[model samples]
Target chain A: MDINGPVESTVIEERPGRRRLPPQERRQQIIDGAVAFFAEVGFDGKTRDLAKRLGVTQSLLFNYFATKDELIEAVYEQVYLNRLAPDWPDRLTDRSTPLRDRLLAFYTEYSTLIFQYEWMRIFMSSGLSGAELNRRYLKHLGDVILRPLLGEIEFAARSGGTPTMEDIWNLHGGIVYIGIRQHIYRTPCPDDPSVAITRAVDRFLLAFGVEQG
Target chain B: MDINGPVESTVIEERPGRRRLPPQERRQQIIDGAVAFFAEVGFDGKTRDLAKRLGVTQSLLFNYFATKDELIEAVYEQVYLNRLAPDWPDRLTDRSTPLRDRLLAFYTEYSTLIFQYEWMRIFMSSGLSGAELNRRYLKHLGDVILRPLLGEIEFAARSGGTPTMEDIWNLHGGIVYIGIRQHIYRTPCPDDPSVAITRAVDRFLLAFGVEQG
Candidate 1:
């Protein structure tokens, strides 16, 4: 099984020149490169190849991150976790604004964030990794993201009853499905996120008897 | 680096005995095993390992399927292409049945077919394969499955204009998303597929102003 190949000769040949940068810039660059690489090759990708892609020695890449597991965790944080801005939950539940407008706006932004090729690739990769990264993310979504949105919807609907998680999932899942169809399956969604969100919100409002303008 | 390991020594050790079978039976067995294996480890899994799992010689496995590529195509055919019954399209458009009933029944059956761990895992694996298997499957789904369902919906609704593919995608995508969340993401859907399909169909009917009992 040992074909005594050059240490990743192909990766080295592609990018012969290496740049010297400050540690902060170098770390960011590594994370960015890792995002694209891991999205393409998944968690099983060789760190040496990733180092080669960065035009750095593998040991030098390890200087910035202690291990491959750490690098992948960084990828999860950078691509999936960090993409959620601090103001998102606040913007979603801001009762001062119209519920319909907030719903449409929040999901439009959320869809835009998650539907990118990099995010979806990494998402599918993590799901396939058996590492429960997606499960952990979904828990975070339920607690930090969807719960607040549902609370706002419940408050706005004024239906005098708390909506079940299933109800919220039905609504939010419809929006997420749009991304899956467009990004994952490569289906060209005729409506942009704005249109899709509005339609989903309209259907949800109609189905749940939530009044809206 | 040459350790000189036996040809798949570990896999062979896992199952020391091999069974000899007729060509047709062996071929089907290998395809079936490959579906479960690929669904589990994805396309990157080793053929020798799959042979071990089936208790067959690696060369014998290769004899049944010329290569890993052929084995995966066999997987796509077995898991996806062949699963759709011929009566599905007719059932979707069967005006003799109520449109709501037909939509719910069709989706319930479709969801049942695809929501299994094998089907969902393989589907996600294909999506992440970068081979556009999902796109190919989506095209198959669009042409063979969703289009006729939409035509039936429009006919039943008596909507003067044809519904665009996007409109149909919205309705159908929501149902598919339910499967993704529950099956792929391991989200425990509170309602069964029938309940979820009924709810989605209800929203769709509401959106299109279709009358439902």
Candidate 2:
């Protein structure tokens, strides 16, 4: 059966010329399109529609992704995993820089990546759909990002008591909420989130009995 | 054409002998079921499926709610608007209580209402689907809840600077993220969030140079 019949009239035919591209470039293009498409519609969107939007035949689209799940997996990697800076863990725990400056810098970079319309919508969509994407990303965030920050806070504290994981998550959540407000809730947020991020980080350090250096 | 035909076999026939409920009671029942249903399947779910789940005929479901949008509006009222305590604003700005204590009390009560699985999931689903429900509720929340709390903070600040809406949003978002982690991310959170709430409120006050009296 021809699942991809005539293209829907609503879909704009952007690729009228249909210029041939290299295999790797074509694969990257599909993944980028999938990220935007899945963000607009939830993951439940049909592959036929995606093919139509991409101006590709369903069979050709299937050449790269055999299943919708495979396509979604690629979207997950491009949208979520690839955005995590590898050296973020290292930079977060660098004792030479004050924890305050490190936090500001890290969140500045992190927010720039995750605060996009597509990223925020996809994250919310996955969570609502009960997909494993959010669970996995959050787990990775805890292990790679929050855990290292927690260790830094524990090292920096002037008082004897150790900081808990919840403390680190609170600071992270506070910073991330700025993006959530902008993209998810569609509310007014600061044009630049550094001000809010700085306040949250400073308050977190103060609560931990760490004086600003 | 009857939209709802025979009951699906997969749906457990709990109401073998449907006991007739009074008009108001039946309306409440449908709204309650809808809150759960939409939270699970999202607002895009069909009325036929909702009737099947509720063990009611589609005609019966339509009697109370003329259209799916109407039903969704009712669900919005039940799940979102009804949860806001009217006196919360008054209590938050009572001034008799210390700002820290007031914040702790407000969030403790606020989280209790919003931290439930149904509430969290529905909130997320609505936001992702681009429904007006979240935007409206958040606006109401800003006016009725956050505005009062912001006024209280500004009143209590020992320093000259007045707190911005972003400041209050950060504190609220940090406290609310505990629930989002539990319900949205399906992660373990503190059994009692009050401890975390207390810590957050104290830190917020500390940032403003308000002594914890």
Model 1: lDDT to the true structure: 0.76
Span of ten consecutive residues with least summed lDDT in model 2 chain B: B1-10
- iRMS per model, in Å, is 1.8, 1.3
TM-score of each: 0.84, 0.87
lDDT values for all models: 0.76, 0.83
What's the alpha carbon RMSD for model 1? 8.3
lDDT of model number 2 = 0.83
What's the distance in Å from true for residue A86, model 2? 1.9
**Top model number, DockQ:** 2
lDDT tens per residue, model 1, A134-178: 888888888887898878767766543455666677677767777
CA displacement after TM-score superposition, residue B135 of candidate 2 (Å): 1.7
Please write out the lDDT profile of model 2 over residues A7-83, one tens digit for every residue: 65464544555658999999999999999999988888888898888888878788998888899989988887687
Error of 2 at A69 (Å): 3.0
Per-residue lDDT over B26-113 for candidate 2, one digit per residue giving the tens place of the 0 to 100 score: 9999999999998888888888898888888878998999988999989978877678888888888888877778777788888898
